[model samples]
Target: MEDERLYAWGNPWFRWSVVSFVVLTVLSFLVGFVVLPSVQRDYTAGGIWASICRAAGLPANWGAGTATDKAGPLSTSVVLAPAMALPGSSDAVGRGATIALQQCSMCHGVQGMSEANAPNLAGQYPEVVIKQLEDYKHGHRIHSFMEALSSNLSDRDIADIAAYYDSVPKARTAPARYSESSAPALVRVGDPLRNIAPCIGCHGGTDHKLGAP
Candidate 1:
């Protein structure tokens, strides 16, 4: 007696199943990558290769051989150095005070604490000030007023102003409304899946990263 339950490539049913699977896969590939991409109006500009890449989740420019452009008008150009952070001499502080009183007191306040919407420069890091002023002067930061003011300032003048601000005492503030336990995940642990670093890593709680104000 012959056994009848075993299925193998020799069997007609098994051979048909294999053929159907291959045919379906080829049809799916053609419809998804070729047929659909051919009909898209936007992809027509780049031609069939771009369309195929778009359908297959590749960058549209991958087929065009173009490099990515990242330059922008307001892109920051200032690089922070430890030397910029060093405290200035009495002469520099005196000069900076005179300049602040003459030019900056309207917005920044006499003591570097702002009563208006302007930022408080009191007790700010000297390097932060140097970087910001340099950015304004070089057109890296776009502010009509700041650019005009910074443009007139020499490197020595900028350093003196930063030193004067650094010499001022910071304004005292009340305790924070939120506690460590109430801090948001983004502030404390950060989003690991997105590769974002915790705010405290740069802004200072336990440790400070260089050039972060």
Candidate 2:
């Protein structure tokens, strides 16, 4: 009995069950990949192989060769370098301050902290500032004032502005102290099934996402 148990393939019942399982699996695959997909109106042009690939939910180009569709709009082109995150030299900061005072202080505030509708820039990651400024300069980001002002700025000038803003401290805010029951559903627990992540996951908690302000 022990030898027979160890050599289960020799048993008629076990062998037949294995064969039955394989046959059923092959039949199911044929039905799903061939029969069902072949009859579908969508797969009529592509034939059997395309039908199989479609039924398996393969990418459109996988069965139809390479895609020649035109690409979509281009996004921001700023690449955050390691040096951008590092604190700037005193001279750079001074130059940036001069530029900011002359050009940016009115909207962004003297210390990069905003008191109005404009966004606060104090203590923001240098990369974020660099990216935004670059975007504005290149016309990737559009705003009447920003596009006009950024168009006149050179690369060095943009770097200096970021350095200046980096030198300023951000305004302090009190910490949140919400009970589990009292906290907003979206804040405490995002709807993951729908692909929405919790705010803290990207914004400002333990998991601080890079380049997220």
Candidate 3:
């Protein structure tokens, strides 16, 4: 009876079950702690996975290049000039509105709400708008679409468009608490091992890059 009980304890089913459990645990640990973090750290064009994908016949432009790669420095000094003399000025607003409708509405949406693939532009700082437009017009920026579109725009046209977008009211939402989730980790304290910078370090709020405003 004791021998039978020992045999039951060491049954093939139990042995296989333990083996399967161990295998699954090891796979999960490797995928979660090792593979996932590596992928996140090296998701850029020069990353390991990017190179592998390219070698396997995937397209090369999987990730976006840096801002420097896309455009040159906006200006030596930051300009705080107001986009428009008066937001309520009907003539300037009307001309800007017309220009936006004709030239910018498709990707940015009516009144600059943005679309599926584009960013919202409504209520953005007028100076930011002017800088971007100027960059697009000059060879500083490298977006094919924006380069072609902005190439023909005069300086006055850019100012008028900036005025219109700045005049629009910004959409507001209740402030979210960051402590409740892990989303703030990258924004607050980036992974030093990966050499990732904090998002808020360069983006405006507590800190900002020069000429960003």
Candidate 4:
């Protein structure tokens, strides 16, 4: 009689375990299918997914984990102002400054100074600076300078930086003047041009777009 009772109890427990296992398998699978993609997408969008992944014991290897991630288990959209960097700029500035620093400082000089490769921007007009930055950010401007610089910046950040640039004065650099008489051997075939390219091409338009030579 004890054996019979034990058999009955054991059989039921075994069947329950099987059912639970199946259910868990199906649940994990369904969760994988239904939630991973969106969650991965959210993970790309920012921090919320990262928070959830940590909470759920999911790895946030970011790019290295499951192709889709755990799906809809995470993800939340946020309506953010145009992230910018200028203090008191549009909501965008909040997310924009970091990107600017990441990209702009090479030729333009850090903190708005201009290296020889580019022009000084501090003394430029706010409107002109704003326009150029927009041109870069929007692709209207075609130089590698603008294209690469603006590709990732949002409009607001561009404007904020432009405003920042507008607040400063152009740095003082010696003017380049051509002197044919100064050259010991000025030959037409192997000679610097009698007149150097016009400065007007660049600084001449201090209040306008710096045109190319």
The top-ranked prediction according to lDDT is: 2
Q: What pairs collide in candidate 1?
A: none
Q: Model 2 compared with the native: what TM-score? A: 0.60
Q: What local lDDT does model 3 show for residue 83? A: 38
lDDT of 3 by residue, 1-84 (tens): 866855574778767888899999998766654566456553454655655554456765556662235565654333556533
lDDT of 1 by residue, 12-84 (tens): 8878988999999999988888888877676565665666677978765555459586776656777788889
Each candidate structure's TM-score, on Cα atoms with residue i matched to residue i, is: 0.60, 0.60, 0.51, 0.37
* Candidate 4's TM-score: 0.37
* lDDT for predicted candidate 4 compared with the true structure: 0.54
* Stretches > 4 Å off in candidate 1: 1-52, 60-76, 179-213
Q: Model 1, poorest ten-residue lDDT window?
A: 204-213
Candidate 3 residue runs with Cα over 4 Å from true position? 1-88, 189-197, 200-213
What is the C-alpha lDDT profile of model 4 across 1-213, one tens digit per residue?
Answer: 866755573678766877899999987765664456446544454344555455466665657554574554212222234433233344434333454456665755665565454666555555555566666556665677577767776756666666565545666655544356743333212434665543434544333224422
TM-score of structure candidate 1: 0.60
lDDT of 2 by residue, 88-124 (tens): 8999999999999999999877987655557778887
Model 2: colliding residue pairs: none
When sorted by lDDT, best at the front, the candidate numbers are: 2, 1, 3, 4
Q: How much RMSD separates candidate 4 from the native structure?
A: 21.8
Cα lDDT of all candidates, in order?
Answer: 0.79, 0.79, 0.69, 0.54
